[model samples]
Target: MTSAISVDDVHFAYDDEPVLRGVSLSVEQGAFLGVLGPNGSGKTTLVRIMLGLERPDAGRVELFGQPAETFTDGTRLGYVSQHSTDADATMPVTVREVVTMGRYAHAGIDRLNDADHAAVDDALERVDITDIAGRRLSTLSGGQRQRAYIARALASEADLLALDEPTVGIDADSLARFYDLLGELNDEGITIVLVEHDIGVVTEHASTIACLDGELYAHCETSAFLESDALERAFSSVRVANAHRPVGGD
Candidate 1:
């Protein structure tokens, strides 16, 4: 299978503090990859680098075989950040309007044509948000809002979707439904890179796991990762580091 993302010995930091050190991994096409780590382990930062939102300090990253920085096809990539669930109540945008934004890249300066509208409709249907397409985004529940976001990605025909802690404040039933939607998307060949704190859920859903703690401890099949000590090793390192931190150190 082709590689959807390739990270080669990437290093990054904020100011003088190091976040990632020689981290490397590859996500194959149609694969569901779960990025796991303890708090402050650079999981979100790593995903940002993968999506070209942030550049690596000392290594390279490629998306769909092109250097991430040079990959100009904006329609092929979709991202849902941790804060995506919190829709501002003041914004008057409706669900359909939000999803329609995804086609802006393809539509350019011209108005959305028939094909674009069809894509938007298909996406809304795929995520089962067609019923609420006209509802105000702020009026929807967390799960409904999330589904709207996913439909936006689908509308753009994104091949790679990167979500960072997307289910943060979602209820249990909603979270389950969200994961089910992700499973269906992955089955349809969208490469997924998920940064999630829920280890049990990730283990059950992701095809592969990349365990990290300022470095790549393990990158392997989810089953193999479960059988190894990578999780314990990574989390233990975080605990050890925390034990020696100065008072009030961030």
Candidate 2:
């Protein structure tokens, strides 16, 4: 019933080049909203503006009814960015340590309290990474490492989880398992916003879809979107084949 994220007529640009033009969307609470777009379609830029990491040239963004620029409570919003091999390659921290870092927003300058420890433990278990909680982050496989990252976000007990291209470079088996985990989390009532390029996969999992190609082509229920011409407008070539295919089918 409540909106987790609301973007109203947003317009953004990089220098002289326009990126997003008149984009508007509203993601309801507990909704798994998938963002699909081609390269340079401003999907990531729109997410950044929603997270307050970047400002839009025009229009306003709200998170949980509060202005994105003014909302300072980050503990309630969790984010997992695109694969960053550089940042993870040289890290020396353990999985538990990484997950514990999420509590920093709440704990501030203090040490981890009892509640923080409980949260971290629960998160690790939720992601099925508790067995490797003490393992070095750099030593784990790609799938395990990604689970650790998700655990870190979960430790914050965030109500909204946003991921940008989360399944990139992972094996098919791992990707399937990861999507299953996301479904479990969503079942627990966490609002999910996923930025993905794969139309079939996003359609299968997300309840709502937003197609962006510098402009908002469509933002509606996944079923409605699949039945409309919006996908053809935004992604004419590759998506044309999958546009009519029922979601979750080959």
Candidate 3:
């Protein structure tokens, strides 16, 4: 099968400090590839290279069969950043208007055609946010706002979705719900690259795990990675002796 993303001998540096050292990875289509690392571990840099936002000093980055930036004209690339906050909800923007902006990346300066309109509607529906399509974006709850962003990503009509720390501050319910969407999207053959700090939770949901600590330690099946000690070393911080669970458990 054709790979969704390929990073061959990729190395980058921010000033004199080296971030990535000869990083090479290939994410298969329909595969959910997770990138786990600590702060300043080149996780964000690597993604930036993939998105054509930053240039790598050496090696090549490819999407599909061609260079990442040259993959296609105006294809969708969903990105949900880590620092997103719901505190800005009262900005006086409607959900439809916000989601519609996702199409701007693909639409020409002239006007949106029929297909673009259809894509916008389908994207909102894909995330099951059609009911609130007409509602104000600032009025939605935290979970709903996050889902709205997910819809925004979908509106990109992207063949590939790359997210950075998507579940950082979300509640347990919202986290679970968002994860369900990731699984559903992956099931539909949408390629996903999840750059996350916590691997314990997402490993079970991903098809492959790329354990990164400055370099790729292992890229293998989730079951194998979890069963071994590598996972612990890669994701040591996420483990809590007593996790905060909901009261009166089922």
Candidate 4:
């Protein structure tokens, strides 16, 4: 299989506070990779780097065989950040309008033609949000709002979808349905990089697992990851470190 994302000895920091220390991994095409880590563990930072939203201080990153920094096909990549829905809470946009924004890159200055409209329609249907396509985004529940976002990605025909804690604040049923949608998308050959804190959910759905704590503890098949001591080693270190930190230390 082709590699969708490649990271090698990547290093990054927020000023003097080191976040990622020589992290390395590769995500193959058509694979669902679940990134597991505790809070402040660089999971979001690493995913941002992978999606070219942030630059690494050292080492390299490649997306779809090209350098991530130089990869310019915006339509091929989709990202839903941790606070994506929070920003949409007050937007006076309709679900269909939000999904149609994905086609803007392809349409450029030209108005969307028949093909573009079809794509938007298809995306809405695929995500099962066609029924709510005309509803105001703010009026929908968390899960419905998330599905709308995913529809937007699908409308863009994204090859790689990277979501960071997308299920945050969502109900349990919605969470399950959201993962089910992801599974269907992955089966249809879209590469997925999901940065989520729910280890049980990740282990249940993702084909592979990448455990991290400033550095990568393991990157392997989910089954293999479960058999190893990676989670114990990674989370135990977090507990130990937190125990020693001052109440208000940065």
Candidate 5:
């Protein structure tokens, strides 16, 4: 299968602290790959390297069979960034308008044409936000806004979908829905690259699992990788206990 996103011996550093050290991985076409790691483990840095937003100190990063620098921007790769730009108060632009912005990479500030409008409408429907398509983005609940961001990526129609902590701020129900939709997209030939903190939920759907701790610590298929030493090392501090303590009783 063709690889949508590939990195070979990628090394990155900020000052003296090394972020990525010989990090090598690949997201196969139509596969869902998850990046699991701690806060300072270089998850975002890897995403930036893939997007060509940050230059890697060493090694190579390739996207769609070409060098990362070949593509000027993320037209071929769609991204759902970590933070939602605006959430408080209210904004004037409707949900549809926000989604239409995804096509900006291709349209470049032009008015939405027939194809763009259809893409926006379809994206809203895919994320199950069609009912609120006309409503202002800021008026929606936390989950709704998260769905809107996913819709934006859907509208972009990129081959590779990279999400960084997309489930943040979303409720349980919406998070489930988001993952389900991503699976559907992956089945339809969209390669998904996810950097998520939550392990249980991500591993459940991702076909391949990758763990990073300031480098490409672990990269392998899901079942094998999850059981390997890399998984334990990447989540060394991550603990999810079955036994719960009451408000004050442990």
Candidate 6:
């Protein structure tokens, strides 16, 4: 079977500053991959390159066997961005309406047909937010809104889902539920890629883990990652720095 995502010797830089260097990894179909790193580690930049939002300076990216640049199957990949939290809360759109927008990629000139409406309903049901489908986005709690966003991505019937910093600002209970939902989606054969900060939680949940710190630190199964020297090196630097801090100094 073809890999869901493939990045070969990828390199990226911002002006004179390099972010990613010789990074290469592949995610298989139905795999749940968790990408972990500190801030400014190029995690976001790597994501943009995968989604074709930004061009890589070197190497190549392929999505489902097609080059990222030439791939035009918009409906095949679903994306839930970190900025969803900041969506204009005052905008008076219902949950169902927001989810329905996922179908816009395939809607063409005609408005939502029966299939589109059915898809919206199905997505809402899958996310267990059918009861609140009519609620305004701003009226829902944090978890509910996050579910609605995931439902919107599902409305596209995408096989690959990518979420960036999805659990930021969410309560523990909500974050647990959100992760459960992701597991369910992955169980049903949707490949998942999550960029996250919580190392323990991500390592516990993800089938595979990829570590980055302006470079590829490690990419391995969760079990192997625990014993890998790469992980030690990655966090050892942080530990050494923290140890040197003066007790009363900033």
Highest TM-score scorer = 4
Error of 5 at 137 (Å): 2.3
- The residue pairs found clashing in candidate 6 are none
TM-score of each: 0.91, 0.89, 0.82, 0.92, 0.87, 0.88
In model 1, state the lDDT of residue 249.
50
Cα lDDT tens digits for candidate 3, 1-250: 7787889998888897777888898888888988876666678888888876777889899877689767665555778777655544557776777778778888768687888789889978877789998888777776667677777888887878988887765678667767888888888889998988766766868888887656766788888777767655644533221223355858
Candidate 4 lands at a TM-score of 0.92
Structure candidate 2, residue pairs in collision: none
Candidate 2, residue 1: CA error in Å? Answer: 4.9
The lowest-lDDT stretch of 10 consecutive residues in candidate 3 is 236-245
lDDT of 1 by residue, 24-132 (tens): 9999999999999988888999999999999999999999999999989998998888876434466889999999988998988999999999999998998788999
Residue 62, model 6: lDDT of 95
Write candidate 6's Cα lDDT for 1-250 as tens digits.
9999999999999997788889999999999999987767788899889877888899999999999989998888898877664564888899999999899987867888999999999999887889999989998876678778888999998899998887665768677777888899899999999998788888988999999877789999999998877766765556335755589856
Ranking by TM-score: 4, 1, 2, 6, 5, 3
Model 4 lDDT per residue over 43-103, tens place:
9999999988899999899999999999999989988777765558787999999999989
RMSD of each: 2.7, 6.1, 6.8, 2.5, 4.9, 2.9
lDDT tens readout by residue for model 5, 1-250: 6578788899998997788889888877888898898777789999989877788999888887778887666667788888888543455878887888898887886766899889988999898889998888778786788788889999999888999998888888677778888899999889899988888877889999888877666778889886788866665633212122245655
Score candidate 6 by TM-score against the native.
0.88
Model 2 segments more than 4 A misplaced: 237-250
lDDT for 234 (candidate 3): 47
